[model samples]
Target: MVLPLELLQQFKASDFSDQQEYEAWRSRNLKVLEAGLLVHPLVPLDKSDNASQRLRQIIRGASEKPIETGKNSESMQVLRSAVMSLACRSPDRSASDFCHWADGFPLNLHLYQMLLETCFDASEDGSIIDEIDEVLELLKKTWVILGINQMLHNLCFTWVFFHRFVTTAQVDIDLLHAADNHMDEVAKDAKSTKDSVYSKILSSTLSSILGWAEKRLLAYHDTFNASNIEYMQSIVSLGVSAARILVEDISNEYRRRRREETDVARSRVDTYIRSSLRTAFAQVSSAELSD
Candidate 1:
């Protein structure tokens, strides 16, 4: 909470590689502050509030020309005053000592996602860093500011693992496995909460995972072979788990009908396998005729 504001006070352009780098970094932080404090603040703003208006004006001016930083700068002092005034307002009226700026919905998720990225080592070809335990412990400290609970963390971690696996050319079965394992936790969390915001995020996240998994699973004849057959189990489990959660937790139709006879995951996997095998067979026959 104080870190963002603190950085602004102590910032020096000399610390960065170049003036451009410093300016870019400064711009990003200013935008983040503006977003967290004004646009998507955890405590809603009245447009007429002087603090909100002042912060907006400062951010607009900073966008056109960088604000002078340092404790002595009048612009920095005024910016800080406006930001703190806006951030201190809370629904309970008892949180005067605390700031609620960064805890807004999508903003919180985005910040947490960036923090989670630090768990992976960029130099090691996507391997998780050795200090992950320490990094994760530190990350937990920001959960309060980010409005993240274990459930949202699990879901976000699931997405991060799956995304990392995809971005790294899908060679790391360990990443895929890690993703599938995290989905188990996410699935448990999904069953427990019906919060509208959580449900929306859950549906969107799982749908993305399911869609990616099914893309390969539904046409396995082209996607898999002898060398990479090991990936099949994890992909299948991931896809099935995502499908189960979407149907069992997010679907109103499933809740109303309560079909005891249907096995959604199993049926879906079966359909993929059958469809893929038929395609494979037809391709083989066509190849023989051409030969």
Candidate 2:
């Protein structure tokens, strides 16, 4: 199965799970668990409350400091662990992880930065490949301890799980053309209709997908803080704005278009948005090692 049968049963739809069975879910899901090894983008559902818009206003307002941080805050630890965890993977995994993390872009950049440092560290004083493999093993351990399936699921309430993986150096690129292939298929269902927030997300997602190639070229710069940064911010803004329109705001514009029924359009939009975010983030970070 593309996804674990057990995992699919649990995540795809609601089901009965005894405590023990739930615990076992994490273990069986590993190895195949995409450890930030793939890339994609976000397009949150729309609501008439316009809450998404309001939230974006606040998020944008506080972009400089997403949350006020103590010298040592939970965010710091989360970022560090995320970065280190990603770094510890093998080079193939590392590249893919960077692409995966790109889904969140600079929003998750601080953690990404930490991964780059570790990548450099491994490059300098250790058995680069072996060391990374070891870290991946350790992460697997941590995943079990953390009840990774449950934790990650809660953390990612959305249906789409943003984990990417690239194990072999010679893996076929086309074999894993980052999803949204099913975006159209999924969108066609009643759930993804335009009046629905899901539909709005689909539309905006495809819209952003169109811009990723331009951003990939800009990754060569270290800071990329000048033009690239501004450009990315604009892209993120578009995503946020679209998400807001879809999830929180409902209007005649949405009903008038009858656009949600169109999956091909949505799939294209999903691809561009996610690819753009991934490429933009890839440039900002230094090096990343993977298992």
- Per-model CA lDDT versus the true structure: 0.86, 0.34
Ten-residue region with minimum lDDT total, candidate 1: 93-102
Tens-place lDDT digits, model 1, residues 34-128: 76877668877776889889888888888677788877888889988998888887786444877756555788887788679888986766688
Off by over 4 Å in 1: 1-14, 17-103, 285-291
Model 2 spans > 4 angstroms off: 1-172, 175-180, 190-195, 213-291
* Best model per lDDT: 1
lDDT of 2 by residue, 1-291 (tens): 123222433341123357445434433332222222121222222244243344334334433544322325554344334333433343343333332332333223222222322322322322124364565444445344333432232222111211221223212222122222322233234233433434444444434432332333223233245544543433333333333334333444545666665343344346656765676576445335331
Reference-based TM-score of each model: 0.68, 0.21
lDDT score of residue 236 within candidate 2: 36
CA error at residue 291 for candidate 1, angstroms: 5.4
